[model samples]
Target: MSYSATDMIFDSEGYHQDFLIDLYEKLLKPRLVEEKMLILLRQGKVSKWFSGIGQEAIAVGVTSILQEDEYILPMHRNLGVFTTRNVPLHRLFSQWQGKINGFTKGRDRSFHFGTHEYKIIGMISHLGPQLGVADGIALAHKLQNEKKLTAVFSGEGGTSEGDFHEALNIAAVWDLPVLFCIENNAYGLSTPTSEQYRCEHLADRAKGYGMESHIIDGNNILEIHQKLSNIANDVRENPRPVLIEFKTFRMRGHEEASGTAYVPDEDLAHWRERDPIVRFEQHLLDRGILNWDWAEHIKCKIKQEIEAHLAIASEDRLPEFDETIELNDVFKVTENQYFEISGEISEIRFIDAISDALRLSMRKHPNLVLMGQDIAEYGGVFKITKGFVEEFGKDRVRNTPICESGIIEVAAGLSIKGMKAVVEMQFADFVSSGFNPIVNYLAKFHYRWGQNADVVIRMPCGAGVGAGPFHSQSNESWFTKVPGLKVVYPSNPVDAKALLIAAINDPNPVLYFEHKALYRTQRQEVPFDYYTTEIGKASLLKEGTILTIISYGAALQEALKIIEEEKIDYIDVLDLRTLQPLDTISIFASARKTGKVIILTEDSLFGSIASEISAQITENCFEFLDAPVIRVGSLETPIPFASILETNYLPYQRFREKLKELIEY
Candidate 1:
């Protein structure tokens, strides 16, 4: 059955002149900005501009119904939504100028920017990332018992993207508090809606996901305002996702510079006649609420306000370089003002720490979930998720395919939706296959969008016990080079437990580097309660007066072993749990104290974790060092299959000897 045009409008809310005109003007701001921004682009003052010329009513009318605290995830062309959110007009212009003071501080394109206080989620350059992110945020809100709704906007063309389907499907399955807003403006870039999809109504797709849905006239601002008012309120109260398709038209081309040569002349003419801002203005005039002169004055006032904002925004200083470090790259569970410390009740292995951390985090927060290859019923190869499937069910403990890229992609896609996905890469050695998704895609997602993924990648890493090179290598250094990825490698059972809890609680994409050598071999008494080991802080296992042994993962055990064997009374040991936001403060402080240093890892010596550490230490604490920092790691060769060769291929015992040599030197 077709939805009548009148069926979309809500008559209860008075659509008076004041309200209608405000909606019309809000819709026009983006179009006007796009026009001017394009002029700047043509003049070489700006690089690109995405115009929201035809879908104004959808952004303005829908956003009008939302509260200031409700979250909005807008797509490339939803600049009008930001206009309603009170984003400064000049900041929008500065973004196009590629100025430091721009919305994304000159880091990302004008379309993808963020402002947390306004509760506006940033846009994703890719079509469907925001859909999943909205769901995740909504899930967080639901779990926290907050009355916040997450609304994600996208174009009709974006509906064809795989992420769109994945996000909506998950949102429905999870029953997240989200509003999936589709601004169907007849065409996507140049492709007509009919050519791209066969769905009779995009909103109907919601039926497959068991979600409530509606199709509305995008040109009718009053109808949009009235319906969204009720829908937003309903979502706030009940907290279930809804899909709304706003049938609208695009008056202008995709961007300012393009002539829109592919758009049919007839289709363009048809949409121009139904311009949403013009239609809404007429609606107000028809009700004897507004006049031509009054509308003109309003337009003039808006233009002046925009110009004044732009002038001031252009002058505002850009974010300082140090401001990027403000957010804690690693997250941890906190019960109160202090990190919840767990005491040792029983001796535990590395894998047990992982399982306990996951169980504790899930028990504490209902929003947490575990997913990856065989992680559900299989409990994962390492059993880090042993009983999660039974405890949380299949929805939370997802058993995914062997597609490494797909696993990370789906996890990343879902993280964007609002669920906390703890992805497992069977072994650390195989992590190379999933590196692109982690480095090029997921790692950069936060930096590109001014948003974070808040997901954990549990990779059992390092070499020992004859697992061979294929199952053993520690490849965390590869991820550490990426700007936004947080790398964590716990040394002891307690730190491992605390770090895992922190990684899940954190709102950033973190690489949880679990040493395969430590998974079952190393045992330490760990507390049952949850706690966090700070991401960028280093824990000094023992403080000494003479030399320092800096290491993490399996090497920490080697350092402790050597200290015991040599009866080294003045040696200091440090465990670096988080890398990326490397604990430089602790490292420099240790170096200053010891005056001698030895950095160790189980990976290849060249470009290893130690290499970066050595260079930074040399640059920062050069004067305090008595001698240049020495390092120990495997030789540049594939870890052999045999036990003897594997032992020789790793650097566990070698690092201990190297640290002694560094102290003697």
Candidate 2:
């Protein structure tokens, strides 16, 4: 019944030094083994190494308080955090060895190893980037009413990054149940903390962001455990973030093969004397909780286990690539040019395929949630998501406030917890508002840390319906430039449904394009059974002998009409569903068949998808081409509200007419 002052103040009688000592022997020793990994790297057993020696107590201490199902986002130096969370030891070692058994399947290095099924999100090396992601995970748990807390670990140096500030500000604003643990070890890769920051403690930075802050003695394991346990419980009850700053030291250089010659002698001596592992071991012995012989036995056992796991990991078979052979990146791909639609002139209307797909997809996936301005209740101005709110409840079909950045940020959070979120923008033109969530965060998070976001962002795009420049546009070229994002434009209902399902199921982020004009005008035969089409593959719509006509979305139907009327020979019409993967194999195969290429789209002709495809084809299939790659698209002019002016600016009959001329040429 007796409790220490620290225990009474935090109401953490459940936390004890005995548990701390046991955790240190089991979890903390792993850090010492990982420290040995740095030397392994120098011996060429591993490629690169990031050291986290002085900050072991903070990682181990904070993680001990979290439940197994709860999540944590540890930065590069928190391998101990993963160890505490029961991440597979062999997998961790395999990651450092760059083997298939690694967490990322050899796609990434050791630093990105937390995405395992153990519920730890993963670690991000791009200093402080994981904070926002952790905040997002926290927000998601709060929204879902899940009984979980998120713990995000960062170094004192990472606290200075812009993303760190953005995460803390948002976490405070939302009162998310997240704990931000800063391992302030005085040095951020050679530069001292005093040099990088003016504040006395990194925890003080929390007040500026309207968050509770605590400065813990990183060397004292019991104190760290009690403090973190208190904050974890408080966060669970109040659902708000708290900042815990652990004042520690880095016993080793910042990275493998790095020097600390600049480190002062007095500072080095002071930090060494306060080594957390040594101090905690002495604390246990002094308290008679553990004997010296028992402590020595624990250390020996940990080393033996690390070596055994490392050897097993080295010998373990990598994940079979055959399992991933059919796994294609989620992008629209074109297949078989033969027309699937039977009969001539079955009511044709010009519109983007994006709209039809959204309509069909909403009917398929009940869990598929869509949110945007005027989307659910208003059915969206484009009416692409019409009847969605009525069919799916408001919970699944949400109407977000005019906060694009916040909406997508929350969407990412939802997706992290296994929810599929399809966020829409009223117009592709206003994507600037959400660009921060898109380009800087969403697109880079997976590549930076090997995480996945099953999110679909539908942008009503392209100009031609006389809605004006802002209302009608196809700006997907801007999004496709980013890696780890699947961009697609469905040319018809079939591609639309297939790509929509693919985007919904895609592990990475997907940017779905729905032209405003295509909302209700275009219709096609999609099968009744719910089926998904693969991304990164293309559909060949028509066969012509002279030139291969490559187009997507609204332009594909236009090209089809023109080729049918003109009776073009062997015209290979390719419908690219996903832009990121581009179906390059299919494209090149078709290009070789026609020996001439013509790219068409409803967007502006200059610097469009056509331009990129042209350059790629010219470089790879130059010998096969009989003529220069041709392109047809909208004129480089702002779309006006007047139908006449809009028609003049948009690509339509002009594109169809030009393709006819090119076939003759």
Name the top TM-score candidate.
Answer: 2
Worst 10 residues of 1 by lDDT: 328-337
TM-score for candidate 2, residues paired by index: 0.77
Q: For residue 466, what is the lDDT in candidate 2?
A: 70
Candidate 2 residues 1-665, lDDT tens each? 11222331222246475665677675557666776787787789888777777678777888788988888777777777778876767878887776777765666786675563677765545655567667667866865788678988888888887667877877887687888888887788989877899987678899898889888887666688777877788778889889988877787788766768878897778777777676666656666777878877887888788888988987976556554332432222234222233333233232334444555566765546687888777877766567767777676777665666656766776667766778888788887777777776677555444556768887778776677767776788888777667797877666666577667767578898866556576776555444567777898877767789888887777777777776666678888877886899989998888898888887786777788998999999999988888888888877678888877776767876777677667
Scored against the true structure, residue 597 in model 2 reaches a CA lDDT of 88
TM of each candidate vs. truth: 0.74, 0.77
Q: Give the top-scoring candidate (lDDT).
A: 1
Q: Candidate 1 has what TM-score?
A: 0.74
Tens-digit lDDT track for model 1 on 1-665? 22333343334244465655566678777767766666767788677767777777788877888888877878777877788888877777777666666766666767777677677766656666667667667766765678878788988888887667767776676677888999887777777877988978898898887889998788777778777888988888888989999887777677766657887787677777677666666656766677899888877887788778767866876556565353432222233224766454788887798889999888886767676778888888877788787788776777754555545655654565466778888887777766666776677666554556767898887777677768877788788877768889888898898888888887778899888778788888888777777777888888987888888888778778878888888778888877767988999999999899888887787887899999999999999999989888887998787888888877767776776677678
Residue 285 displacement (Å), model 2: 2.9
